[model samples]
Target: MKRVLGIGLSLVLTLGLLSGCGGTKAPAGDSNAGGNAAAVFKIGATGPLTGGAAIYGNAAKQGAQIAVDEINAQGGIQFELKYEDDEHDAEKAVNAYNNLKDWGMQISLGSVTSTPAVATSAETFKDRIFALTPSASAPAVLEGKDNVYQMCFADPNQGSASAQYIVDKKLGTKIAIIYKNDDVYSKGIYNTFVSKAKELNLAIVSTTTFTEDSQTDFSVQLADAKKKGADLIFLPMYYTPASLIFQQAKSMSYSPKYFGVDGMDGILTLENFDVSLAEGVMLLTPFNADATDERTVNFVKKYKDLYKETPNQFAADGYDCVYAYKKALEAAGCTPDMSAADICEKLVKVFPTISFDGLTGEKMTWAATGEVSKSPKGMVIKKGAYVGMD
Candidate 1:
């Protein structure tokens, strides 16, 4: 049983300019309109429905769906969900966008990771549509744009929180930071973690970068860390590689305590992973399945009943992201003139000072820098259970 805290307000983002396209105001649930009969709004997602990153993408999809369901149930503004699979590729995301174009979708919830998010951001800006990513962590997504927004915290905040977790706990003196070189998401997280580690006075034993698609054989990195006598390792890679590295490290009888950024998830897929191997591994993430607040508990129950599986962190963020938009749309009075682009602009102006009662509890008001100011909680995988670490 996990304890729940207050809800938090998430990140604020400015999107790109909207093209002056003719807008349509179709009646709710018109199949001719390419939306559900009961839906007042239709949102699309371009995510990896299949492929290695599907776990993360699927979680995002589920989260968006949860929001749609909740909003429609209350009979406020009926919302519909549309999902497009990009298979975690940039080119495919464009193809997905073209598909949604025929469906007349203007507000999208997609592009889980940075690659697709970046690609879609350019295209959505060109189309003047509003694309909100709940999981994209790269800062470049928000650089001088007005149509894209991310609900999840960026790597800078997550990295700072992770570093603080180690420092606050006095977990280790020396740490190894492992990251992928070319990937924007991994690189962004690595940069933030490095900067924060220095501020926290944690000695960086090694700064190693790996090719995004290539394997980072732990042998070389571990040998280097062993040489430096490091006490902890911060592997800032996504789940696929992180799991492999963990297994490889265990094979070498190397068991330094581990910490990671939000890119790490799906621990159940790790190889040769027993309870002991994952004992002390921790991550700085917004998704906590163990929340205990009334809304959170209700959300978990409703989600499990609908999806027949437990909800992940990305899903939670997605649910919150849609609701945040819904709140702003409501404030804007969801009129025929109220386009997603208008809501996006309203989001930038509204988020800075608004408190949201989210599924996670009470989220703090949005920060002026476009990030959430709420304090983050830590979770450790102890004995196969994710427990909130104090």
Candidate 2:
């Protein structure tokens, strides 16, 4: 009888031990396999969530979140996303990358801006983590980085495309360019635009530059363009400086036809910005929220309903980035239980072969060099809204 009791007690103790072992949670960065919780791929991104460039960052985060929510609801493949604020700083971006790495980020949305993307791209390459940037359009962001890709048009492409569109439409006779000399994004676009303009025999009347310190005062640059009889001004910088330039130009009553690149997208939403100053502003961008396509209409409606504002090109690019990732991951048959390196390898192999159609572009394909091929659309700001220039 005593021996029977001992055997029963031992069996109960063994059962309790097994139960405790089963209840032990999986370590951080490991996919939880127990229960009905679906395994989710972890995606990490870093952008300027609280600085001057917060508009771009927040737009990207929200857009990507919407994609994630939709995908999660579908119950096919799920994703967990986390975005860190880099404040548009390169050093801070590197720190953010490290943080994401520690959190077991299986994939990365590199950065919203070029400088930070450039900084983080190196770390991703070193760590064998795949990255797809929504709006970091610099060539250097993809240079020597096979696992990194871009969703937005590269600076060179934007510059060359802008020049071609302007020439094709006969938008201006004499073009003047004002670019930030210190910025990689601005300088890259400026160089390509000048090359393309010259190739097309377009007359360039004035070319001026500004550094970060002198961006607020564009009076000298505008005066030079006006003096040179420039009928149109091309701005390859961001919206902040562009907004100031518009104000300064309006103050002097020098209203030439203003043309901009993707960097000028958020000007319409700029706080305290007078929409009248941008009455006829033209920009070469990939996404037009006012597009009548069903996908665009739905995305715009959802964005407005959730954020209470219109979605911009950056937001569209971010949305496209996630969908592109989804397509590639689905094509590659990647599982959430895979290691980050394995996911990176699968994505790097699969991205070149898949064609993605998203809010920003249709039939978008990535080159081996990680540059995305997509046509840009011309948008004109009319009555405080972006109208497709067609």
Name the top TM-score candidate.
Answer: 2
Candidate 1 displacement at residue 199 in angstroms? 2.3
Local distance difference test scores for all models: 0.72, 0.89
**Candidate 1's residue-wise lDDT over 3-75, tens digit each?**
2222221111111122133333343432134333223576777888899788778888887777776666674
lDDT of 2 by residue, 238-279 (tens): 899999989999899898999999989989898999999999
- Candidate 1 is scored at a TM of 0.85
Model 2 stretches astray by more than 4 angstroms: 1-38
lDDT top scorer: 2
* lDDT score, candidate 2: 0.89
* Residue 382 lDDT (model 1): 75
